[model samples]
Target: MLGPVTTSDPLLTDRTPLPDGLDARLRDHLTFLIEVDKLKTVLRASPLAAADRRENDAEHSWHLALMVMVLAEYADEPIDVGHTIKLVVVHDLVEIYAGDTPIYDTEAGVTQVEREEAAAERLFGLLPADAGVALRALWDEFEARETPEARFAKAMDRLQPLLLNWMAQGGTWRTPGVTADDVRARKAVIGEASKALWDAGRHLIDEGERRGWARQV
Candidate 1:
């Protein structure tokens, strides 16, 4: 009989050989799908010009990871910033499959959960077992919003749209009919996760209204 493999041997690691078909196929499909998302840029106004630049799904994940790096101190509670960042980074992998839906679009937002759930099942399922399970769990945590990590991650997601709209002089709000009050009501949940960011957002929304930048809800 062959001798038992050594526990500390690097070769003993759980990697499986890359096969030629389905075992390797879904990951490629996922990659291509996510790439499409990055190419699907948001349409903005004026100088914002939507950049004609689509931020790929990977870039979106990386951007949120960057936010977690820089804004973690502002979190309402102490957090494992690394873990928090990881959660945010992977939170949108599902967007690759479901496509990015703007929160302000009420009807689009309604189907988000279902779409994302389908996405989660498909995308995470692409990976080999262990990694797939781990990624799915992080994705699930964000969806459930039942943990501190999830709460902060979700807050970051909401905050991103607010920042984009504000930077573009109310890109989302500038739909010629989007009101300021609507922005507040839409973004109020920011407080539930991070009061600090919420307060800042309120100030921005208030000033946005005063400056006639964003319409009031």
Candidate 2:
């Protein structure tokens, strides 16, 4: 039988003194990774496509990342697909700390900006200085939505929940105050990214109305 591995072995301890600043930087990187795992438990209002349970921030981000990859060609303008993927993936990291705020919560939305800004700094600050800077910039870019990558990323962000709500037979839309018009208004920006996706989303909305699952505008 092979000998058991030992933590004290030279092979394990042979790592050279990580250059002066590298130890702290690498620790920061690792700490950030562990901290972000909290996102998996921060649940959103939207349910999984086929599951009754609500999806969490991490799953939502992962779905949007995959959506960006598969739907890149449908973007209205040429975009950096790679950058868009990063934007979608990183966009919700703040929610791990800030907690998921529902879209129609206008009062919460008003405060969400401030709360998430603080959360962004604290969460991204876990990374090495340079890495934290890059991620914070990407998070801000996704928020501003001025660039094509940001726009497309935002589109996927909006579309995913719409598809899920429709598939779940009007998940959040079933809330007493939510109406088909409310859904339309909230999701309007999705058209700016990809007309094709918007069209499909519209069809889903229409079907929901027809089935009396979602309210008519």
Candidate 3:
């Protein structure tokens, strides 16, 4: 049997000095990692498929990453799956700062863009200059939905919660005054990346309505 492997703490131990700029870069990177740990504390409106409680932003991003890996083939246009995964992962890190704005909440939607833009600046600025610019660009690309990868990533982001809600027996679908039409309108972005995914999502919405899990308007 192999014994447990032990590693030294690089920060605690005296070591050969890093090149001038590298030390500060490592510190900034570590700080950003510690800060993003807060994302696990940020609750979302959607519940887990099996668990009773709502899922957190970190869990949501992980799910989106998995969705991209599993469903990238269905994308409307050819996409770089690796790039799409990166997009999904970085996409919601801002929710750590801006907080999640539920799609069905019209009032919150009004300020969503403003809040998230500020969050992107503050959160990504935690990284070293080159990394900050690169990650921030990925976040911006995900938001724009102009590139094929961005469109597919956005599709996964929209689809994950919908699947969870259906699995949770109408999770957010049961929100007061949220009808089937409302869900269709909000989730239609799924079609921009893949008609097939939107078709499946629409089927769920229609079925949820028939089963009284969703309101029909």
For lDDT, the strongest prediction is 3
Give Cα-based local distance difference scores for all models: 0.68, 0.83, 0.86
| Model 1: per-residue Cα lDDT over 8-99, one tens digit each | 32211124433456545565545444443432352312232266443455655666788878888888878788998989877876665566
**Weakest 10 consecutive residues, lDDT, candidate 2?**
4-13
Give me the displacement of residue 28 in model 1, in angstroms.
8.7
| Clashes (N, CA, C under 3 Å) per candidate | 10, 0, 0
Which of 1 and 3 is the better model by TM-score? 3
Q: Which stretches of candidate 1 lie over 4 Å from their true place?
A: 1-56
Candidate RMSDs in order: 11.3, 9.8, 9.1
Q: Model 3, 47-166: lDDT tens per residue? A: 999788999999999999999999998998999989999999999998876788888888887778887888888878878999999999999999999999999999898899999999
True lDDT of residue 169, candidate 3: 82
TM-score order, best first, reads: 3, 2, 1
- TM-scores across all candidates? 0.75, 0.87, 0.89
Alpha-carbon RMSD, candidate 1: 11.3
**1 versus 2: better TM-score goes to:** 2
Task: Evaluate candidate 3 by giving its C-alpha RMSD to the native, one decimal.
Answer: 9.1
Looking at candidate 2, what is the lDDT of residue 72?
93
Local lDDT at 168 for model 1 = 68
